[model samples]
Target: MSRKPSNIVYAAADKVPLGTLISLGVQHASLALLFVVYPLVAATEAGLSFEDTQILITSCVIFMGLATILECWPRFGSGLLLVQIPNTSHLPLAVQSLAAGGPALYAVMSLIAALSQLSLTFFTGALRKLFPPEVCGVAVTMLGVALAEPALRRMFGLADQGGAAMDLRYPMVSFAALVVIVVLAIFSRGPLRLFAVAIGTGVGWGLAHYVGLTHGPTGRALADLPLIDLPQLGWPGLAFSWAMLPAAILTGVISAVDMISTVVSMQRMDDADWHRADMNQAARAIRPNTVADMGAAVTGGFASASSSAAIGVAFATGTTAWRVGVVSGVIVVLAAFSPRLIAALSVIPDPVVGAILVYSSAFLVVAGMELILSRRLSDRRIFTVGLAVMAGLAVAILPELVDATPDWAHPILGSPLSVSTGVAIALNLLFRIGIRQEASVPVTTDDNPFEATTTFLEHQGDIWGARRDVISSAIPVVAEAAEMLLDTGVAEDGVVLRARFDENDLDVTLLYRGAPIEIPTLRPSPEDLLGDAAAVARFVGYMLSKRADRLLLGRLGERQTLTLRFEH
Candidate 1:
C-alpha cells in the first residue's frame, strides 16, 4: 500500500491558499532574518562605515533569498520546504576573514568553501554509510545545544550585551511568548495552528514595543532607516592567506554534514514509511545549496547552508509546501531592497529571538534523540553515542575550553555541531574494527530455542549497525525456523546454528544430524498434512518458504542443513 505523510496539512507539492502562503512566508522570512545579527556583528567588528556595513548585509540578504528558492528546486535542493539563511556556524571564519583582508578576502574564502561542498555531491551516495543515524543524531543534538545556550542566556537576561543592565521583563515577555506559541501549536487546529509561530512572534514584538524594550537605541536605529534602498556589492580582498585554507575546507565539510542531516530529517517528515536514509535524494537536495553558496561568495556573503531549525519550526505548521519556500524566498529578496523592513527585523528584542529559538530548539533536540534511538544499540554503540554526545556538550557547556583554545582553533571550538560530528565519524570508524560478519553458536532442545535465536541475532544486528527494519523482519523468520528444527524432532540431538550478515544479505543455516526440512515449492493439502510427520514437515517448509526470501535444503557433510536467506 502507498503511504501518505501523517500530521501534514499540506505536503510538498500541495497548493496552499494565497493568504496562508503570504502569512507563512512572512513568518519564515522573519525567522531567517534573525541570523542577520551574526553578519551584523561581523560588520560591526570589522569597523566598516555605515554604508559599507549596509552593502555587506545587503549582499548576504540577497544570496540568502536566492538560496531559499534554489533549495526547493529538485536538481538543486532536497525538494522539501527548507529555508536557507546566513550560516551561524561560519561566524568565526567570517570575522577572521573580514578583519584580515576585508569582504573580498572573505568572498574568496567562502567561494573555496562552496567549491569544497560542491565536490562532496559526488560522494553523497556514500554519506549514509559514513554518517549513520546515530552519528547524524550526535551532530543534530549538538546543533540544538548550540542554539539553546545563547538563546536561554538572552531570554533570561543573563548574557552581557555591552554590559547592559539585566531586565526582569525579558523573561516575563519571552516566557509568555513561548507559552503562546506552545499552546497554539499543540492545541489549536487548522489555520490557527498553521500560523502559531507567526502569531507568537508578532505578539512578542508588540509586547516588546509596549514594554519599551525596543524604545532605546534599537528604536532609534529603525526610525532613522529609509523605507527602501538599493544594495551595493562589498569589496574584493586584495590580500590572500594560505593559513586559512584548512578552516575554509573544513567549513565546506561542515556545510555538507549539516545539509545531509537536514535532508534526512526532511525525508522522514515527508514519508510515513521511512526506514532508512536515502543518500541519493540527500545528494540531490544538497546540490542547490552548493550552487547558491557559490553565488554568495562572489557577492561578498558568508557561505549558506540548510537551516535545520527552520525545518523544525515550520513543521509545526503542518505545511511543508514547496510553494511557501518559493514565496518566502521571494519575500526575503524583496525585503533586501527595503532598509526599513530589514531594520525593523534587526531590532527584534533579544528575548523574543530567544523565545523563538527555544521553540525551534525543542524540535531539533527531540529529532536528534529519535534518530539516535531509531536503531538498536549494543555495548559498543552505547559508548559511541554516549562519548560523542559528551564531547559535543563539553565544548558547548564549558566556557573555559573555548577560552583556552587559541584563536586559530576558535572556528572549530565554537561549533559544537562540527566537533560532535567529527568525533562521531571517527569513533564510529574506530569501533567498526574487530566485528566479524560471521558468527556461530550451538543450539539444543533444553532451552527455549526461540528466545535464544532472538537474543543472538538482535545482539549481532546492533553491533553490525544493520538496518532496524531488516533486522526486525529477519528475527521472527529465523526464530520460527529454529523452533521448528527442535520441536519437529528433525534434529533429535541438537543443532548448530550459523549466521552470516552483510550490507546486502542475511543468511542463517542450521546443521544437525537428522533429515533435512523439505524445500516445498507449493502448498501441501490439509489431507496430506493429516497423513504423517513428513507431511507436517512439508507444510512447515511451505510456510518457511513464504517467510524467507529464499530457502535451501542441503547437506553439510554428515549433517543436514536448512538455510534461510533474507535480503538486507
Candidate 2:
C-alpha cells in the first residue's frame, strides 16, 4: 500500500494554529537554552568575574535571538525555520583566544572570523567543489565524536581539567537522566518526544537534589540576582594579534560548513520534496549567520551559528513553521533581560546539562553519518571518510598530540573538527585528481527546466552511446514533463532527476513525493485545452505521451517515481 503523506505543517511559510505554534515555540526555546553551556563554559574557563560572565551570557542570548529572527526573515534568512546559537565547535578556540588576550582580543578574533565567513559566502559555489558531502560529513561526524569527551567529563563530575576527582554520584545521576531521555525518545509520541531533553534534565536535576549532589549555584544565590539590569553595550576592545589569525580563519571555515549542514538538515525536515540542498540557498543562509557572528562579537559575545539541537527539536515535533522560530527567538530575547531567569538557568545541574549534551550529540553524529552515506560508498569515498574520521578521533582522544604541535599551528591542528575537516578535504581533492567527475546536479524549483534537462541529456548521451539527435530530442520531452510537474504543483519543493545510462537505453527518473500522476496518450481537443486548469493538465499529459518512448509511474510509501526511458 502507498501510504498517504502526513498532513503535518512544515516550512517557514506554512501556517499552524496559534495554540500549536505557541507550544512548539516554547519547545524550541527550551532546546535552544542548551546552547547556554557554550558561553558559560567559555566564561568559566577564562576566569571571568560573575558580573562579566552575566554580561557575556546576556549578549549571547540577545544576539542569538536576533540571529534567529534574521534566519527566519523572508528576505535575508534561508527562509527556513533555523535557530541560531553559539557554535560549540569553536568553544576550545574561543577559550584559547580569551586566555591569550582578554575578552577584547577574543572578541576581535571572533569579529575577524565572522568577516572571513562573510567573504567566503561570495565563493560558496567554488568551495562546494572542494568541500563535498564526504568531506563535510566526516568533519561533522568528528564534531560529535569530539564532543563526547566533554559530555562524559561533565557527566562524571570531572569537568575541571585540573585533575579533579570524579564524584561518585555524578554518573548515577547522569545515567538516570540518560535512561529517561532514551526511553522517552524511543517510546513517546508527538510533543512529548520533543521534550525528552528538557524532561530528562528535570528528572536528573530532581535526582541530584534529592541525593544532595547539586554542586553549582544554589537557589538562594539566584534569588539575589536583580530583577532588571540594562545590558552593557560597547565595542569589544580590539587588539591586533598575529597569533589569533589562524584560529580565526579555521573557525570561520568550520562555522560555514556547520551552517551549510544545519540548513540542509532543517530544509529536509521541513520540506518533503527536498532531495538535496540548494547550494545557492545555503550560501544565502551563511550571509546572515556571518552578520550575526559579527553582531555577537561587537556586543561581547563569542562566535555564533545555527543550532542543530533546535533543529532536532523541530524535526521531532513536526514544527518547522518560521513563525514558531520567531516566537522562540522572542522568548530568548525576553529571557535575556530577566536576571533571575538567567541565574536560575545557570544553576541547572551539571549532570543534567551533560545528559542533554549526550542526547543532542547523538543527533549530530547520526546526521553526519547520513550525509556521508547519502551516496554509494566506493573505495575512494570509504578511504576519504575513514581516514578523516580516524584522524579526527585521534586528535580528540589524545590532547597531548595537539600540544606537541608548534604554537603557531596549534589553532588549526589542536581541534579535532579542524583536523578532520582538513584531512577530509585534502584527501578528497587528492583522490579526485585523475578521476572523471560524475555528471550530477541537484535540482530545485528555482532551477530552469530547459537548462537542467538539456544538461542531463547531453551528459548521459556520451555514456549511453545515444545519438546527438535523439538526446537532443529527449531534452524538450524531459523539460516539458518537469515543467508539467512544477506547473501542476505536484511536488512541494522540486524533484531530483537522476539519469542512468545502460547499454540499450538511457533512463531518467524524477523522484518526488505526491499523488500518482496519470500520463495521457491522446491529444486534448482545442476546446478542452482552452477550458480550465484541467485543460493544462491534459495538455501536459498529451505532450509526455507523444514524446516519451516509455513512461512508468510507481509509488513506494509516499514517494512517487516517474521514469522516462529512451531507446539508444
| Top TM-score model | 1
Query: How do all models score by TM-score?
Result: 0.90, 0.74
Give the clash count for model 1.
6
Q: Check candidate 2 and list the clashing pairs.
A: none
What is the number of backbone collisions in each predicted candidate, taken in the order shown?
6, 0
Residue runs of model 1 more than 4 Å from their true location after superposition: 1-5, 159-165, 215-229, 234-238, 445-447, 466-473, 486-496, 502-528, 531-534, 548-568
lDDT of 1 by residue, 241-349 (tens): 7988777888888888888777777766767776667787777767777777777777666666677768766677887877788888899889988878887777778
Give the C-alpha miss distance for residue 1 in model 2, angstroms: 23
| TM-score of candidate 2 on Cα atoms, chains taken together | 0.74
Candidate 2 lDDT at 185 equals: 66
Candidate 2 residue-wise lDDT, 220-290, digit = tens: 77678777777755566887688778878877877887787677666555655443456677777788877
